[model samples]
Target: MDWERFARQMATMAHDLLEQDSVVGTLERIVRSATELVHGCDAAGILLMDGGRVRTLAATEPMVDASDRLQERLQEGPCFDAARLRDGERVYRIENMTVLQQRWPAYAPSARELGIGSMMGFLLFTENENLGALNLYSRLPGRFTETSETAAWVLASHAAVALSSARSHAQMTESVATRHVIGEAMGILMAGHHIAEDTAFNMLRRHSQDRNVKLREVAREVVELGALPRPEQPSRQ
Candidate 1:
């Protein structure tokens, strides 16, 4: 592949991913581009890890989905290592998993049985956090080369920064909405009870804690009901 042409294609993809309104849409475009742009990549996917749980954000093929779940269930594979940032490795390229029988044990033989010949994974992360792994799979042995690995790594890096930005934006939006709802509920309390803002907020918090409900839930209830519900009586065991 012409490096110049590839770079131009990547530039366009970067613009699209950044401009995407939703995180899922951005990730789906990224995964699809990997299969089309990366040399020797027969399929592509994104693996996301939250806490200890793993999920596939996007996959170009069902094979990619199966592979991701296999890695998750067995707790092994290049994707897992790259996503988890274990051993401080940002990328993992496997030309042949058969040669890594001892290194991967269960995952190696299992991947071979699934018809995976070679694969690569790169860590998707930003300065503040690690998002996950961007993965590519091939059906032929020794499919990935240094050039392809380098290209995939660059793509993954761009994806990581975009993912981080999108997530931050989403969190900020949710926080703002929550604050708006809480403020509305507080205003309702103040108008009904003639209490100060601080006092109204304190009452809401006490009600939330006493009822073992989320503050947002309590606020929503107040906004809908125009008053807090009576506290539940303790059950006699």
Candidate 2:
């Protein structure tokens, strides 16, 4: 490996990750960078454990998704362990999936059949939160080396920070937009019904709770309809 060139590339990747417009874009860039920068990495993806179910994100190839599904079905794999934060390790590498008859016995052979000869998983985490696992896949046995693992570790570190930043920014933007919409709705209600601002807001909140809908959705309905809809009443039997 050209250490100098690799370092420069990693720097570029870090900048690119921060520049992504959304959380989804940041995740896509993270996986794409893995295939480009990690030696012997043929495909890559992120696996998120959502309510005990596997959610695969930004898969670079069908093989990546297939590997994730295999792990999800069998309930074990290096990526699964990394995402679930099991065994207290943030990084896992299977140097030879074809021969690994242990430590994921059910998953190794299936992964091999999916053209995954070796795999590496890095837990994307920060001080406050764990984002997910970034998984790299190769098509040839013994493809990943110690150097490859080092490269991926650095990439994962940068990826975690970038993903967190992206999500925060997106949330801030959405919050601002929601506030604007709600304010508009309140203003419309106050003008139409000659009610105070607090009363208008309370009405919206009551509607939201009664309908079991988001406050933003209720507010949007007020803005669009120029008035609050009547609450649904219980129907007589």
Candidate 3:
């Protein structure tokens, strides 16, 4: 592959994704485009760790989906090991899945049965945060070579940046919307109760703390349902 041409094409893809302004759409484009760049690999996928489990965030082919499921079900595979490794460590391949079955017996046979004979996985991270892993699979035995490993690393780096950017954009959008809803709810409380702004905010905060619910949720309920139940008065003993 011509490095110059590839770089230019990847740059164009990144620019197009940025222009779309939709996180999910951008991620879908990224995974598909990256699968094309890494040669000889039959499929590509991105796995993300959420709530303590790995889940397929995006995949380019059926083989990729099968590989991801194998890892998810058995909790072991190149991708899982790669993501758990220390920064800069790479799990390039599982030579002889049968012999290696001692380490990940459950994952090896299933992965091999899926027609995945060779694999390369790169840990996806940004600064201190470990996002997950990007995996590539091949049907031929010993399919990934030194050159392919290097290419996988490059693709993984690009994917990390794109995934992080998309996630950050999504979080910012959600935060802004939550703030808007809370502000509107506060206004409603102020008008309905003839209370000062600070008092209304404090009431919401107190309710949120007491119930262990998010401030945004409490505010949303206030706005949507008009009023919350007041704490009942205690009778004199």
Best by TM-score: 2
Per-residue lDDT of model 1, residues 169-228, tens digit only? 888989999999999999999999999999999999999888889998899999999988
Better of 2 and 3 by lDDT: 2
Q: What are the runs in model 3 whose C-alpha is more than 4 Å off?
A: 50-52, 86-88, 95-106, 126-130, 229-237
Candidate 2: misplaced stretches above 4 Å?
126-131, 233-237
- What would you estimate as the lDDT of candidate 3? 0.74
Q: Which 10 consecutive residues of model 3 have the lowest summed lDDT?
A: 91-100
Per-residue CA lDDT of candidate 3, range 25-69, in tens? 766776676667767677777777543477777787778877877
List the candidate numbers ranked by lDDT, top first.
2, 1, 3
Instruction: For candidate 1, report its TM-score.
Output: 0.90
**What is residue 223's positional error in candidate 3, in angstroms?**
1.6
Candidates' C-alpha lDDT: 0.86, 0.89, 0.74
Models sorted by TM-score, best on top: 2, 1, 3
Better of 1 and 2 by lDDT: 2
lDDT for position 12 in model 2: 95
Tell me the TM-score of each prediction against the true structure: 0.90, 0.94, 0.84
